[model samples]
Target chain A: MGNSFFTPLSWNDTGFILTGVLNTVTISLVAIIVGTLLGLAVGFIRAEANRFTNILLGGVLDALRSVPLIIQLILFSTYVGAIGHPLDPFVTGSIVLSLYSMAFMSEVFRGGFESVHHSMATAARSLGMSYWQTVAYIRLPIGLRAVFPSWLGVALSVIKDSALVSVIGYMELLRTSEQLISRTQQPLEILIGVGLFYFIVSYPLSLYGRYIERKMAI
Target chain B: MEYEFHWIIVFQKLPQLLNGAFVTLHVSVLSMLIGITIAVLLAIMKMSKARIVSLPATLWVEIARNTPALFQIYMAYFGLGAFGIHLSPYAAVLSALVFVNAGYLTETFRGGFQAIPKTQYSASKSLGMNSVQIYRYIILPQMFRRIYHPMTNQFVWSILMSSLGILVGMDELSGETQRLQSLSFRTLEFFIVAAVMYFLITKLVLFSAALIARRVFRGDL
Candidate 1:
């Protein structure tokens, strides 16, 4: 078992696979950074906007949230390509990941904003702070700190979900592992390696999230 | 770019898409039922003081939560085959999802168990109930109530994640969409319709869960 699975593999083959890890990290970094920024903006709008706009945006965001990320990725990839606005798979994957992350992140951010006591906002107003000033100085710092764990959870999910880009033929870690398996016919070893790679990347984030939750509880 | 839109192909293919939706629902509901049963046991095991009892459950939840569901599905479908154990795409998706659903719900349910005051167990024991009776007659009912909403949310998650079955060539919603779009060359319309179908199914599941919760729990929950 060991000889068959382990013999044909060289460091060069492993190096090829590690390149997929680079793409995976790059895509996730872009998605998380852009998604969180957009999410915070949308969340702020949702939390503080007029009633009419809130209802409109809520309906749209909820619709986006309802569908699965894989479906969104496939649909977005195919739809854009068929419409003659052909995009590279990485572009489509990143766009879908960012959009999907934005939906959940917005909800998380909204919850964070809503959890802050209204009295704090009222006090800020009493001090003649402008709405923007109150948001920047009072609500954001407190709400962001409170939602850090939830945000971390979302970020971790984005990293994990980035694996689905392989479905669209984006040559990320999972896809690379799939190719490597076909070449080596050693599915067990290659997949375990892939899974362990993910675990290593994500487990620290999970631990940090638990740490943040513990600190916040105190 | 002037692109022609083909709404008619989507309307014509609605029946196939609906069949795929049923497949998606079947996989999700079955997985959730089995997953919850396993999750309850895992939660109990995790709460045990003995290392032999708790270690495995903790490791399962740790690995399951940190990894991607797609990887789990691939490993089940592809990795198991390496061991000469072949599973059909449907079976692979179901088993993988059951693993993941149980992993997530174990924590949710452990939290539920913790929410039940320790006094309830003592009270039940004082009434001459043994461990099994205390759990069955006292702990479980309240745990179910506490975790009902989150359980429903997980059900929705199961439904959504079943879309991953497409990668394994399972003829679920996304798979059917891919096949039909490639055949008709109506990629845009087919996928747009598929996305709408997914959106509707999820909303329906959420609404139905709410309705059932209202009826079953009545005023208590």
Candidate 2:
């Protein structure tokens, strides 16, 4: 080893790492927002629909959830490219991540929706509110509040799983760190820095997840 | 559109793919077993009133939980090499996985232990049992019953995450599939097969876990 204990990090390289961090966070946020909405829609469709629609939607969700996200990413990337469909890596990662999150989020929403007593909906309907009005004004709010904690868990998972985007050359934090290590041959310092970066990002969410669980428990 | 689905290429690669599946199964099962041992120890340590025990366990759990499994694997595989401690790809992946699994399972088991009523412990202690005996007879069994579902869920998660070991050149199912896809240039076929195999194995693992959980926690389930 050329340098002892503390070799200074080049600011330029660290800047590159920071940009990667921003990409990771952006992808995770977009995935969570879009995924939650899609999941809520699908989950309600499954819950409120006839047997055929419920089964169809449930089957789709199960298939999506069962396949590993990494494999799904590869499949989507290849299939899209093969079909002569041009999409950017960021867009591809977001789409795949959103689909992945939707699988889990739908289950969360389903559980939440079920927790809202049927009487609530029936009462709202009897009060001259339309079906859509009851869902929008009454049921969804309560259901979403109940599901918030689980959604937080799903969000944390999404953040970590988004690292898989590196496989498709997303140049996220993990990928950037990998490149830095290869170039600088400073695996220890870079890995520690990268690990710390992940810790900084994930630790707060984990604590917040626990906080949500505790608050929900109350 | 011109590319054909080559059944011949798939059939020829089936044996090699099966071998890869075996490797995947081996790594997952071994890691699960090792992980449970680590988890149990960590759980006990976390629950222990002693600071000496709890502090390290807490730190380990926090660090491991916060970092991604992929990063952990890279650190184990590459970080240690810088310190003149090199592990083979298999060993590195397994160790990293065991560490990751242990972190998650510790929380699961801790939750299970917490769910047990304090009176149960008191009753066991009153029955002329020592600490060890009380733990063996009362706490451990009850903990498993309460956490069986979550523990099994973590096991499935661990299996899925093991696919990441392909990064370290473990040549598991995903690794083998990537190789086949490259050689045959049948992207869809090879990947579709790999995906189906993964789904089936995950289902099998989950099913067995559920069955075992039922048997163990018959009354609770």
In the range A121-143, model 2's lDDT, one tens digit per residue, is 99999999998999999889999
| TM-score to true structure, per model | 0.94, 0.93
Please, what are the lDDT tens digits per residue for candidate 1 over residues B127-219? Answer: 999999998978888888889988888888898899998888999998888888889888778878888888999899889988888887796
Best prediction by lDDT? 1
RMSD of each: 2.6, 2.8
Chain B alone vs. reference chain B, TM-score for every model: 0.93, 0.90
lDDT of 2 at B132: 97
Q: Provide chain B's TM-score, model 1.
A: 0.93
Real contacts recovered, all predictions: 0.80, 0.57
**Scored by Cα lDDT, where does model 1 land?**
0.90
Q: Give the runs in model 1 whose Cα sits over 4 Å from its true position.
A: A1-7, B123-138, B219-221
| DockQ values, each candidate | 0.75, 0.63
Q: Could you tell me the lDDT of residue B220 within candidate 2?
A: 65
